[model samples]
Target: MRVPRFCCFLLLAIAASAYADSEIPFAAFELADSTDFTTNAEKNLWLLAEAAATAGDTAGNTQRASLDLRWEASLNRQWRAGFSDRVDGHFSQDLKQSDSLNTLREAWLSYRLTPQTLFDAGRINTRYGVALGYNPTDFLGRGTVRSASSADPEMLRSNRLGNAMIRVQRFWDRAALSAIWSPKISSKPATSSTSLDWGASNPRNRLLLSGSYRLAENLNPQLLLLQEEQRSPQFGANFSRVLSRQVLVYAEWAGGRQPLAWQEALPRQQWQVRWRNRTAAGVTWTGENQLSLRLEGHYNGLADNSRALAYLSAAAGSGGGQNTTPVVTEWVAPRRAALLQAYWADIFDRYDLNIIWQRDMQRGQNLGFAEVRHHIGPVDLALQWQKVFRLSTHSRVLAQADRRWQLSIGYFF
Candidate 1:
């Protein structure tokens, strides 16, 4: 019998906690139900076998129950360990399997080589970027997401798989440097719910180097270089500045020689490599009323609207069973976009509101999401709504809309 990988990590965390100075354990249970509404144009496109795989996801009611667990321990003065895991059970009215999925979000060990240096190994959820709506410099985030219940960018980033890597960091008074190496573990992605899914996180051997420096009292900048097997190296940079006590600005950029987005999705298509750039710039303002507002602009040189339409048209006509819808919808970046966001904390006692609006400039489509949450003691309740407008064809852009509503109840212990 083969043992599950997360069970090993759980045992390790327990063993380390026995002799650790401090150990923290966290657990949470949540139940959510979602309803989706799809337009006629979208239903027509789903006739293709390639898009049929996701047809069940378009218009249905899905209910999910989830349990989240986390453990962190400080072993003596030189060592530390952490682990996070989530289990989900999903049910729906549409004919399908009642799936039970488990995700190992993080499992890592850290050692203090010196007071100013550190070493880390195992699966780590390292994140990089300064923009809130979009992140162009987050190179390690590709294909790492296992499951997402919410469309909120923050929630998507928090509940994703972490890559297995060895990392080293050195810190100084005004600067820091980090290096990471991740090795390939599997050639294909796993299909089982209980799988560790190492292929999604570490599909190829990769190396990353990052450094950050504080140039002024309110300005800090970070630079990065990433190299993967059989691919050209990519360069990235990000910077943030505090303009005033209640105002801030940030920018993130990445550039590399790569094939176009559509070509990457359709492997049979001719490949052309050229220099491309992706960028995001944003500013935020906070008021005394505990409300924060933000505006951001995004650009991607590798994406062309016409090519994206052609790709969709081809997929809609193909008879293959392979699902390429996810690649086009989730992985491909828009050529030009804009985002607006508003967050109000403590609007009422123990209540919060969040709203996000994004516009695709190239396709002239829009998406909007809003959520209202209430907290009472150890339990929380939330209601969320999302609206998405998508393009349908290459000749004429048909506006197809999909709306979704979700309600959630959660308890933390």
Candidate 2:
């Protein structure tokens, strides 16, 4: 398998230097095996072909070994640096060279201009929003995914590339302000496993300004303004309140003039722009027994299910040929959806249970995921199950598997 040799060497050098100073870097290794049962969607030849072209084979088993490393150090008293990286190797009957992937999730340096002021430069994973399932205000995470190993939203968000940017922030007793600028680097995404695909993360010059104020002991509200090249500026807000020690509610919203989702997926389509809003609101409750439950709702005003299905139908009818540009299936956000999650930590002495269920309110599709994990010292063992229903003719083919099962064991060092 091809590895990013130079990047690996640089990381090792950094780790060695950190160790020389008597600091230990965090590291973990994990091995996982997964089996998938796929449903036959061949009733629609076009959709079947499209799914094959974009989603790859959905019915198979694979084993993977992964290493995750993270390090943070203080360089003198005013400056600091941090790095995060992950590497994965997949082994299976159908494994390909590209299946081995390495991601430099974050590498940045920060300078504390004052006790409450800081400046940061380099690739940084700047995440915003306060929702469990969907994040409407995460403007910088549009197309940054390089490899996906799981359908869990938390895993997906943690395993993606970060954008290269310069940021400045200042903090007060009960308020904070920040600004960021990320410049366009490459014009197209890199396809090689070892290439640092900057285009996927920073496709356009962007600027973001955000501020937050604490209005009460349990209420802090954040406001944001984002501008990107060749696009209308978007406005965003996040608010959360704690009703008591056991309950909390939160909401995130973003709005801007944008084209329809389907129009952005298909090529040469007439582009129309209008004010659109996306929102996610959720509430979580935790009990004394250590069981936490959450409920969330999402809305996407730009998503047009009818238009999306029509475009797929037209492409299928035209026999777009195998060489036809692969349709963008990742744009399949439901116009309305709901998510439910449950977590019981230390249900047993050392076991944890986590469950998630999401429904596409508009099309009546459903997705369910559950996991049980056991911890033993520095080792963890986990089993995961996922299933999807009523998604045969939908554009969300990535999650089209009928069922999937995964077992993983991890060790920490």
Candidate 3:
């Protein structure tokens, strides 16, 4: 997964300080008193181990273990390289299955051309978007996952796998531009059981170009243009603003010509003539007590309400059609959509709590989630609970509806 963009500022600051002292700074070194730390040098290797367990009425018990390793080395002033690897071992009592696999999550090489231009290639996580809970304008497929044990946006983002691509970026006084290209990237169908492979299904290579400008002291805007293989061109824009010292606002919109799956004669068919528009807007507030609150509304253009209902009705007929199409599952149009989130940081100065409530305004159904986390030394512990509700038989909300409780722990070295 990609780190947050704010880290770039830290890197820039360090680099500038190093040049001020008449030297180029390496990543694995620190500017501090020799006696400040027991070790004079920073370690180039990092390791983390995590264990997670879940219990639910339907899923009796499930356990998983993961080991993550990262190593980085600076070859020269103009070149740097790093790799991240994860090994996973898991077993599910409900399914009576167990498996283990090792994955090279990310491996990239970076080259600096002057102080304002940079190039990166290899497996890269091209994370883009300005929204918190959801991002419709993230055309690079930032890969969002719904996890039971963690709702922190950062943790949710960390679960995404990177794509193979080459990227070039250039920075100006108050703006930046970037371009990315992936020659051959394949995407697995949401309903497919097989792993995502180049041979499973051939997806077109993709290209993205984006530009950002700082318009004012409190406002920044971005524009994104994307061209994917076998897909129509898409245009998107997003903006972030500081309304006040305690308030912030953000929004995103994307428009393009997309396929209408439900209108097609076959379930797997797509009529590419249809036009789609997706919109999301949200506001955040932080109180004196450090409680963060966010409320957002989203509209998914691909989800056609009448068409979705008609398709579901037909599928309910006597063996009329199987709901095996990814279109049906992926394009679920609810009558109404809204998200409410609240987070309390530094509770008792040691605990953090988060709550999320989702409502299907049209069907009057609800999905509730809560998580509590505690940090102790190099280990972090968390507990999560979720409840799903169904009000209509045809409603797509909570298709895999179930209540669950999960516990997870992580140790870093």
Candidate 4:
């Protein structure tokens, strides 16, 4: 994974502080503190720049720079507004070109209708799920970026694009309810003809109604109902519990008519609930040695090994292009059926190490990743390495078949 150099430093800082004897992780505490009613409106600016080289015949080198500005204002005792904008510049060797993009990341207004009721509208980033690496219940999935050339997981996570939405929420002593509606926006720009066809044709317009309850002091459970424009509704639920001061366990499951592939020759329905169960369970451990360990297991019933092999074979026989069936080209084996992750922070109070191993049990493939970060004031230096191996597949056919490494230094101001 490409590590966004600056985010590595931020994670290191948070993890270092997480060893404190607190029931919740540092991230949770930070979020809670940010929403305090007494806090004054303020503006902040963040700047980032980094350069790296990859071992490839083409596009071996790249450079990136970005500036982010965020502001919040309290319109009144009950109304608040937030704005965020980012400007990014990139240069890549293979493209032999440089490009820049200006993005309006978030622009939202929030109102506290009452002490226990809240409403939010406008472009917003909506995130759900308690899992760290992957969130099956996060229906929106992480927003897409303009480019996929960078490997920093943190950067990718933070650079989420917003969707137009309206939400209402009410909180009780031990429970809460939320209703959300997100409209579908045209993915591509309208042509000169002003046809405006794609916007109405998209099927992503949807609604979500969810409820959460604190059954006890340590157990929190949530339920979600998702309604799409032209598809059947889906259901999801998740829970997290504090086993002890240093341990936490969480599970998430979602059921829906997920899309699947059929044989190229046999005309098959594009979307079917062949495997409707997607579930994940995991536990995390934190200790005073500035160490954290997480083990997770994910099961995706839709990933049929036989189907995947057949799809791959068909795609190969069809020359792996548009000639291949759309479903065959789109279907992929679940990548994270099993995962083990470890983190060590404040190594000498200035360095951190993170390691992860993941396996696609059905595909018989595994991946290993390691990254080390060193902090120097506002600058972060990092080195990352990744390797992929296939146990029962063709020796030469692997995504991470070759070893890859990258070194980058990022400055934040």
- Highest lDDT: give the candidate number: 1
Q: Please, what is the whole-model Cα lDDT of each candidate in the order they appear?
A: 0.66, 0.66, 0.60, 0.59
Q: Using alpha carbons, what is the TM-score of model 3?
A: 0.77
lDDT of 3: 0.60
User: TM-score of every model?
Assistant: 0.81, 0.80, 0.77, 0.76
List ranges where model 2 is wrong by over 4 Å: 1-57, 94-98, 265-269, 316-331, 388-399
Least accurate 10 contiguous residues by lDDT in model 3: 13-22
Off by over 4 Å in 1: 1-57, 93-97, 321-326, 329-332, 389-400
lDDT of 1 at 261: 62
Question: How far out, in Å, is residue 174 in model 1?
Answer: 1.0
Better of 3 and 4 by lDDT: 3
- Model 2 C-alpha lDDT per residue in residues 281-397, reported as the tens digit of each score: 988776766566789999987776656666665655566422222233343567899999887666777676778899988878787778787766545677777765322332434
Better of 1 and 4 by TM-score: 1
Candidate ordering by lDDT (highest first): 1, 2, 3, 4
Worst 10 residues of 2 by lDDT: 28-37
